[model samples]
Target chain A: MQQNEENDNPPLFKSWKGMYWLVLGALIFQIILYYAITRYFE
Target chain B: MSYIDWFVLLGTVVFITVYGIWKTRGTQNIEGYLKGNNSEKWWTICLSIMATQASAITFLSTPGQAYEDGMRFLQFYFGLPIAMVIICVTFIPIYYKLKVYTAYEFLESRFDLKTRSLAAFLFLVQRGLAAGITIYAPAIILSTILGWNINLTNICVGALVIAYTVSGGTKAVSATQKQQMAVMMGGMIIAGIVVVHMLPAQVSFGDAVQVAGEMGKLNLVNFDFSWTDRYNVWSGVTAGLFLFMSYFGTDQSQVARYLSGKSISEIRTGLLFNGLLKIPMQFIILFIGVMVFVFYQFVQPPLYFNKVETDKLANTEQAAQFRELEVKHQQNFQAKSEQVQVMVNALQAGNDTNVETARQSLNSIQEEGKSIRKEVKDLLKKANPNTEARDTDYVFISFVMQYMPVGLIGLLMAVIICAAMSSTSSELNALASTSLIDIYRRSVKKEASEKHYLNMSRLLTFAWGVLAIFFATLASRMENLIQAVNILGSIFYGTILGIFVVAFYFKYVKSNAVFWAAVLAELIVIATYVQTDIGFLWLNPIGCLLVIFFGFMFQVLFGRKLEPVEIGIEKPLKSGK
Candidate 1:
């Protein structure tokens, strides 16, 4: 019952899980960018 | 340091302290003192969490780390976002639903009293020592560079943190962190700009970055998986994940930061904010170091960045040899400067072959300079074995003193001091909370009134502050301040993390089995640290896995009746009793 109430209705994302996924995606994006920076500079 | 620098440093630090005390003036009860009356919004929690994690060492030593070792250290945080997600999903709701003050209070409901006590004991020990490092790290460095007495600096830093922390407790810590985080990041950004601007007029910021990249300072990620390598992608994502989970999930200093949130959603948002911003913030600071590295390419840097030790060497019989090495160092610097210029020109001309050639030449020059520096270190060590010959901690401060404008120098110094105060205040506040909640109030004086407990909290905060100051006075040089703290945390974090993981998941594993398993796992983890070549990050996962593995084995071996406890997500208060 408490869990149901605490399910955050994020303003941008539809669900809390979606926000987590977005954060994970952002991390991946950063990693890919860093990789590109490394390869381009190397 | 000039008068402007002094005024900026003192003014910024004094204002923050007074503001923290004034803003959190009233706390008549234990709950208000320990948990800030649950009045914090997401932003305060976010900044408080960030400030707690980033110590003065982060400011003083990280740029120096980038200067010496490059930005690969950024990989250390790769697992943090995932850890934040895990904590938000698993840890936060449980803590909030339980309405627990310290994270250990949840352990008691899930397991038993001994289990909770053991976890709390581990936290107090590790964090107590860490509090010392947080205070000592910047105090020693600031004093050495600015010609202040180290003892006095430690007291001053410790005293300021104690003032607001003892007065306002968690509210004070959270209130001041908002401003400290502002000054810290703002100062760092300003320093970054000034570093790039200090570069020769011909070198654009892009050219400076290209130079740093060519010299291999921009190696941010390595996909190569090695068990022994500390900052590779695999260890970072795997071991780093476990470490961050333990730090955010179990460490009271961190737990207390978010536990003050007005709601579970606020805590989640605050943590996710940290997860997203922390990496970019680290990247910026490291890039500042990279820029500092590039700045030194055109302008000659000392053979040894630690001038005190080098100056002492000048007075020794090794003075002649040091002078000879200095000449060689000067010549190497000239060659490296020319090669760097060639690399810059090649980069500007868009000639890949010349760029590669010049980059290789510059790398060789750097290698030669390193050899000379190593010899200088050897000579310094021979002159006095007690000397801290490692100068990486001094690099950034040396740059600030030598090159930065006067007012900015003070502001940067204020940045370091504020970082120290912010982190130390949180640690002291957490220490006092855990001591009072987990130990003193729970065990020693269980029937104390609300007013009595509040007074005890204030007393414990002051006691911990003094203990930290005492440890700071006795502390010596570490190889790198940031890594030293992390290594210390990793040593104990894994074991604590394991206990929490078992409590949250393994319902059949009773308190006795987990209690003993944690003890054995902690011993084995310590043994592994003392005996093996395993990277410190791996210790987190290792200790965690050891406990889970041992927990199941011990439970079956002991033939304890498997009374499955209800580990459901019902309102924790209703579920626990």
Candidate 2:
């Protein structure tokens, strides 16, 4: 029953590093988008 | 409230509670009770983590914060994803490998019994007080807005949560949160749509955002760095990372959420899920508040959002002065409301010049409105020194009670109530687990039957519930309920995080060094909090760094006399058995 990458093999990514980057990348994207909104609105 | 409203509120809450109880009915033995028998899926863990973090104060005070302070508060969560990444990378595997029941359990293995106990005690002190606030914040607000008894409201909320949390423990808390999160998101979405719909017929959703921006309500990010400023991009990323790392990394309320996951991937996936969605969640909530700001551009909001204080003020001799200010606020609103339309029409026509001219007019009136509000607050204090005059926290709830349609009111109430219950259950569960795993079993009772320990866990959970109720009773005035929680967390979280940081990375710094380091670091954090104007977020990093620094310093002085320690070492769980 314990089939899901016990050694930290992520479902989609080759490694957990990919998942971490994806999240950090999303954070960066959000900040850039939010900054754009701030610039555009203000 | 109407009959239908009351029915909807009670029915929704009751069904969720019953479903949680029925679903997690047979939680027998200490392992199932504390760790949900390690059977939780990733999605359930995700929502449970968010639910535990949200609390009643989040639902009650966040929108109000946005209404008064704009979306700059979104920056407060900027460090969350980063923290999630760190926890996954460094904290999760060690925890799973160790098979620990609480975060502090890892501390004992890495350092010693004293260090672990010290961390547990800090968590208990902070999470205990937080449990009380989670119950009290919404109940107090609900009672104030609806003319109900505050103490009765607190007891009822506490009792409702205890009813389910005591029966099933961690499993019940997690199982019920899925339903609670659904209600929370669904109701908030409806409220957002309704706010936009309630805007003037001529004003489009796009137009409202434009208006909010022109009025300085869309302040989503501030790049400026200041030690004193609470929320901005710099603080959010740096100081916010430390705060969140401490929270999700060290605090058992959150740690317990992920620790229940069946596998390392489940915990990591669920936590990353939180990172992915949390900002958007906060953004949506804050955006709704901004839309309410836009809605009020067309509709006249109360001069003071707290109706009770205003009504009480009217009965006093200063009624004439208050009445004069109300008239001034109304006239000011009247001018701004019309000017808003002119600006909106100017935007439609693509006339930047006309928009700028009208924006100037709106800004001037808004400034006048601020001074008028300040005068009213000053006069309120002059009328009765005992009255709390911070009305911003009441803005969103008052708007909801005054304007949101009947059934929606009930659903929204369920959202706040569910938030309160969901978080309080987590705190109570975590408090009980920490008490049982760290204190009662480790120190007081050396050996016991599994059945006895199971019963003790249930009893400790119940005891914590009663203590939370007691703490709620003694709770007094604070600035904003949501920020109040964060401020309290910041004071203690840094030192806790620092101790964990030292244990994880600096093996040379053994138990005695880090324990005293944490102690010194905590004292300095409290002193800094008491003695400085530094923003609360900075305290997280300051306290954390102070611990690492002191840990190294103390280790240098004390390392020659102690046994060696190593990382990634597992400790057996002996107490819960």
Candidate 3:
């Protein structure tokens, strides 16, 4: 049976862990931008 | 609809359909037909998944949602990126190891055939109906807005989808969607820019955004928590997380997308890209709606966006009352337009006091306009009880027809139809593969050749296409079935996801416990839905967690020695091995 985990390496990140953090961090950054937009416009 | 618009719309749609069929022609092998020969790149998988999720209502209703409500709805997607990462980590490796066709195939390997069949049956029931809705929802909207026959529109869209999907299956669905996603995002971005340009010359883009903010349409982040409130941050993260997890992980339409990826890493990249892009896509659509609201503030908008009902009201006995309300609406627009200018001017000068005072006055007048609009809807309903009074769905399409240029109008129409076809094709392709691999070969015809299975796959795809069109035709007569279908999806998705969660996570829970637990959990969810006012979205988590909790209990009581389940595949998928 095939298991591709050993073959996987994401670009710009040494580990998939770093890649996932980037996604999560982007979410945080997005929420902060949205909150700022809401506050500034209000 | 000018000649150029018609040409562009027809030209773009026909081109995509033909391209899909041409690209995937002569797909005689089962692997090639069902999984695109495992040749898809990350970009194709990304676009296919995104296109499958974004139906026509997403394009039509999202902007309108922003127009009526605020961008508070963006919170609902806060959970999507997180769900993507989780799926990439937990779900992808298992499916790749199993070399499964449908997500349901993984269930059989981990548990029992009954468990796998149960999940597949639930998917067919919900997604089968949803496929029709994918076509019907937009067809009805476009038909009403463009004065075309709803049935004809349904058949055209359905037939166009069936032509390519039946011919080429998964490869066709993925190939066509690249173009579909391009048209969808391109049309929306262009529409957003155009709406900003359409605003009064004196009002800058920043000024218009502030007016929307003042008018309460830019409520992007609502940190407040409430159980009953739909779009708050609290509910979006929790309930919304379960919903997306079930959708992206278990649902075959989405699973089929990444399942076609050439490598597991490519699939992971595709999903991660989708996670990153999905929220921004929704924001653009909603921002366009807000900008349309700002544009309408300067220029007079219809008292009601749906003119069919309003026109019908004009010939009724309530015509005089309708005319009076029309005049009142005119007066309301005149006052509101002038007040908007005042607010814009105050905002520009940075005079906070004048801005606040103008905002208050503007909101009061906006309230008056809202009441007037409600009165007109009530009048329309009174005139004809069968009239569809809510016009929010019509809001964006009406703007497109009225404001967008000739060639661009055709492109926008292409965008709507492309969204419908993209999702519908995925549904058909997934349904066909599920029906073939999960049900027929496994049970009905265990020893069939690949040629026979390939033929069956194409035949099943065509059958599902016809069924979807039949349901789309049937959908026109049913009132509020869209909401019913959504509730239907939420109702079953939790239990289905629960079964898979057990298959993956609950190492101790055997088939007997997990299977029966799923049944009981579904029963409780249905009973609660019928007996209580609890929102439908909550059913997903309740159903999921209940399965886990009950599986543990049942495992302690009735659990017995496991039947050694078969991992049926004899070879590796080699999926980037």
Candidate 4:
């Protein structure tokens, strides 16, 4: 059976946790931006 | 279309197809064919996953959806990033450790063969139907707008996909997707920029956006909560999360893409990349549609965007009445155009009061225009009962054909076809892989040689392509192509996701409990979909929670000590432990 040895290091982020947080942050930023667009344009 | 346009369209599509087949030649083994030799890097996996999900309908109907419904559609993807993180943490490592070809293979190891087969069968049913829609959607729209035969268009798209998919399998699907995604996004961005440029010279990009906002087309985020309201913050975050979890975690079409990654880390990277980028890409596409809405405010759009149906009514006895409606539509457009100018001037002058007044007048005229358009649609349906009365899907394509420069038109058409082929190729590849690995090889041909299985994989790929084309012929009855695809997936995805959720968690709930639990849960989900007005996204969480709930109930009641079957592999890691 083939086994995948886990690699903890990502290319850019300090850790996978960091990457996940970054993605979450991006989502929050986008939602905020869209909400701002809605309000500003309104 | 001009000769130059034909050349560009044919040149781009043929180049990509030939490149995919040529690059992936000499794939003779089942692993190489089905799993792309497990050699794919994160970038290939990223593009392949995104390409498979985008599909032709995403390119064709989404902009039009935004054009008609506003950017609220974007909220539908808000949960994707969260789902990506969850799958990366849980699903990726498990699948890689297990070395499974299909997601259902994990179910069999964790639960039982009946459970695996049930999940695989549901996938085949839903994905098979969706594969046809993937081909039919762009075919119907391109055929109508470009005056091509719909059947021939369907066959052409299906055959192009089958050619490469059957020849080189998953590798070919991934190889071609890079180019397909490039062309699809590049063409869209170009279209977006061009649409803005095509706006009246006096209307700056900001002005166009402000006009769209004033017309209520920029409603990107709605914080309000309603169970039946499809795209809102609550539904998008909670229900959308479950839907994405099921789709990326359990669906073989997506699972197969990442399963080809060279390492678990690479797969995780690929999925996370998609999660981070998918929403913004959708925003650009939807923003383009809003810009088109603004563009049409200055120009007189057709009374009906679907020329095929509208043209059919042109020679009928209803033609006179239709002409009257057309005349009224033009008058409405003229009046709305003037009001838009008033709003734009007020906006430019920085007078909030005048801007508000002009905005109100413009919105009222827009309402009158909508009523006239509705009457035209009603008349068209009365004139021909078979007409697809919904024209939102045609809005963007109509704009492209009537206004875009000739060669770019060809590029845009290629973009649509490329999207169709990229997604269909992935579907056929996944469908064949799941069918061969989970069903055929496991049940009927357990002792087949590698060469024999490889041959069967190719044969099955071709067979699924044919079946998809057959289904495409009957797809006309469905409403808006994008919504139809999502609706069909929702009907089954929740139950399938539930089975996987159980297989991962709830260790004490044995196969007997979950197998029957899944059966009951799927039936209930389907019943809910057919009988209720609950939003489709809600089905994912509903179906999954129901499975977990019932599995526990069954285990508590039955208390059966059935011995677990050893499938000649390492036992899966108990999820939490």
Candidate 5:
């Protein structure tokens, strides 16, 4: 089936855990910057 | 503006409409009318999807958004690429496998007719209002800037879209969007460049960025975990993901874009293209606002950019207060302008301490101006009590009208108009498709000929177009263009996305479970939205999860499997009289 063809291909993304961590890190960094600007800088 | 600029504006519209209609002449069958016969290549689908998402508000308000809130709004899209991957893996293949024209068509197969109707109805209500806003947003900008009648602008914009859409259907919509996207991108790039060029000779691009950064306008990321904070990291990931999933994954306006692809791979490629391009495109657009912020630091801008409100205020007794505020604004601008120049020189000379001092000074002055504007608006409201106040939404339109060169001004206007039309035409087409296929064809007339359906579709398309225009006239009272449309979407998309998710993965949950769960979830979502003041984006995830969670519980308690409902995909089980 054509659905299986998608499975045969290397997934568009892999390692959901790693992906989650990467996004988390970016989010953390962004929040830190937001804090610096809003709460601390001025 | 010069006569040539008006000529350019009118010429672009007439030429593009004639071009799209001439190219997409034949839309004979329902498939052709709805999905463009699945004949479109990847790029056409890509452009169509991009154009659909990039409504008029994105152009007119995004820069103003950045001007007010900084670039943190870009974080709201951090989850977009991830959502695209999820949709590609799960949603795309299922819809392709089903060969469904509308996304809700699969709901009946997996659950019941009520579930399908429920999902489809949610989409129609959300998308229909969104279409109104899409048309209304750009028309408001044009009417405010050009001093044209708002009603006339709404009707003209709505009628122009219905003409091409009713004539050529989805094929015309897709084909025209490719050109619209091209024109929009080109016009925006030109505008950005011209904004930089029009900046005072002393301020270079680097200098502008530095000034903007100092003023806290270059802030692009926010990692805060607060649920109520609209554009923070947590909201962007959790809530924003659900919004994107529902918007791209299940909404027929978007699904229909990919449904027109020549092959499954083409659709996947189209979606992936959007996934990769959407964030960067938004960043660039918002960055234009960042640049506008820097530009305004050098130039004296209007105290309130919305002409209608400003005009009314001018005639009021508060005019003196407003004039005083403008004088204070100019004085503050002058002070900040000198500091920016000094900072630029210091940065060039590698004096970090001087740059830091200059940055602090600029930031403090900006805050002072903001506080002063707030006081001024309060004073105005206090004076008149019923006068319209707040005009941050008018900043970008005011900038274009005041600064952009002649022909380019017209082109920028065309870009916005094209965005309005591009999104509205798709909505009108999708609304008509759902109305006919999900409601009329399935429930009202099951054995209609292809010709009958085609005529009915066109008629429905025209009817919805007029309905949107009527709604657009009423949408004038809504505050914040992007937030208003999104609030409308968040009210519905989550429930619809949940229905599809359950159909795809929650196999044990029976039809009755999902149907009742969806109804209950929708009621809960609406009630929660009304009762709370949480950020609108979070509602998307909350709505979807509520339905999924409730559906499981409903099935566990019911014991007996619910009857699966048919949705007229096959021959009628019992012939109608």
Candidate 6:
């Protein structure tokens, strides 16, 4: 019964674009933070 | 080291184990036993993924890696985000659609039985050795800090994790991983913050980072193109992609984490989240190490952090020489620490010339310290041949013990235990699943009922857990736990990932060709690894590419005139009727 139900539903996935954007933003944040802390904060 | 700390550490672990078992109770069949009935939410999957990757060694040795090598190691993970996207698009859909118990199970459907068995066997070998290092890494920290025997600590850490894993299976593994992640992250954040706090009152967090930067420890990104250089943009992007793909895309340890997700979306989200989170998580861990490097500039660090060897040297004829080096090291650190403060002030004033001068002075002092430390290490080796001369892995734990408050010390210790349990439990769970589904049920007892298979999985979990503990007892003689685990993986992951890549994309490749090719490629890869001094990271790509190239060559030479076998993907969770 459970297996049948799982099979019937198309797997739920979020927007790949959204995931990409979030990841890119995170990368930028890390770079900037790392730079700002080490370079300018001193 | 206090009773209060032990209480907190023991209580945290015991509670997590009990809670996990309670939450994951009623796992009656193989599905629940291995993949948690594919009913796990995204958060559960996310935490489980993180827990599996962040071993005790990450907690114990990463700071030391940062302190010694600087933050250049961070570049090694630069390819992970890209690797995640590739796995989600390529690997996830295949596993989800095929519904396989182990990732290797897909190989059988795509190619042949030999291929499936080959992949599973490789994963077992890699993860088996990895589990030992995970347990051994944290046990070293505990035994070192508390002055206990390493073997007993290894047994204790290994047994505690195995106890819970044997009882609760994948469900318990996932549930406890969530708790462990929480504790591990909390402890790390606290530890990072406390390191900043423990610095001399004159040194702000900015000053600490500035000092570290001046000492050349903040070099997070290097665009160098060298295969021999272990952590660089070229190696990280190309070779690192293959390594991550092989590890997350093909290995059962990671495959099983996503397999437990309630839906395809949840698994996808969990993986994508991991892709987003993992690089930064590693960065923070490495950053903590960077901060530690700065902290030591103001404080006089041990000439050698490895107590076992340091103690031996203390009783030797060379003890006076080592003491002289220690005194020289103290004077050098004092001068450099003062110079670093001046450098920070100059940088703050936007004076590039003074900044450059300060940097050079800091570098010269650092060079002198390195020589003295090397002298001490040589004395240690002369005093005790069996002792490790490198103590980079012990730096963070040493800081925690000497600096942190009592309550927080316990919390950080719990974090190490949690990290150990997180990775160890995942390994045990994966090993049990592979043994039962891929080997036992597939080859040994094909006619067993679901209940029987489930029982077998539990038994295998206990058996593998015991095996891991036995391996952990022998893990102490290793040089560095984190690198040792990765080196072990590099030995097998490439060929395993290679077989999967062929199974997925190379349609004309027959199972017999791929199987023989994989075997030969594995041997060649191992031979190259042992004979060469190339950085270990390169092995991942080398092993993988060798399998594909060899598999194709074998197909062209030996696969002609033989009828191709029909490869049908099987439902992994559902027992074949």
Of the candidates numbered 3 and 4, which has the greater TM-score value? 3
lDDT of 6 by residue, B1-577 (tens): 8889989988998899889777877778787788788888888898899899888888888889999998878767767777777787778777777777788777877776767777788778778887887787778767877787888878777777777787778888898998999999988988899889988886778767767777778877666587688887678778888888988898788889988888777787788788778877888899899888888777778877776667777788988888888889888878987888788778778788898888888788889888888888788778777666788878888888888899888898899889989999989999999988888888888897888888888888888888887877777665655566778788887888888887776666787888888889889988998898888888888888888898888888887754443334432233252
Q: How high is the CA lDDT of each candidate model?
A: 0.88, 0.88, 0.88, 0.88, 0.80, 0.80
What tens-digit string does per-residue lDDT give for candidate 3 at B207-267? 9888999999988998888767889777787889999999999999999999988888889
Ranking by TM-score: 2, 3, 1, 4, 6, 5
lDDT of 2 by residue, B24-57 (tens): 8887788889999888889999999999999877
Error of 1 at B273 (Å): 1.1
Instruction: Give the per-residue lDDT of model 5 (tens digit) for B88-117.
Output: 778887778777778887777676688878
For model 3 chain B, the run of ten residues with the poorest summed lDDT: B568-577
Tens digit of per-residue lDDT, candidate 4, span B373-472: 9999899989978666898889989999999998999999999999999989989999999999889988877876889999999999999999999988
Per-model chain B TM-scores are: 0.96, 0.97, 0.96, 0.96, 0.95, 0.95
Clash count per candidate: 0, 0, 0, 0, 2, 2
Q: In model 4, which runs have C-alpha deviations exceeding 4 angstroms?
A: A1-8, B476-486, B561-577
Question: How do the predictions measure up, each by TM-score?
Answer: 0.96, 0.97, 0.96, 0.96, 0.91, 0.93
Alpha-carbon lDDT of model 3: 0.88
Model 1: per-residue Cα lDDT over B1-577, one tens digit each: 9999999999999999999999989889888899888878788998999999998888888998999999999888999999999999988877887788899988878877888899899889888888988888887788878788988999999999999999999999999999999999999999998988889999998899889999999999899999988888888889999999999999999999998887777788889888888899999999999999999999999899888888888788999999999999999999999999888888899999999899878888889988999999999989998676888889999999999998999999999999999999999999999998888877788776789989999999999999998877767544455456667789889999999899888877988899999999989998998999987888999999999999988988894587678653322431121
lDDT (C-alpha) at residue B113 in model 4: 82
Docking class of 6: acceptable
State the displacement of the C-alpha of residue B253, model 4, in Å, after optimal TM-score superposition. 0.6
**Scored by Cα lDDT, where does model 5 land?**
0.80
Q: In candidate 3, which residue ranges exceed 4 Å CA deviation?
A: A1-6, B561-577
Report the error of model 1 at residue B131, Å: 1.1
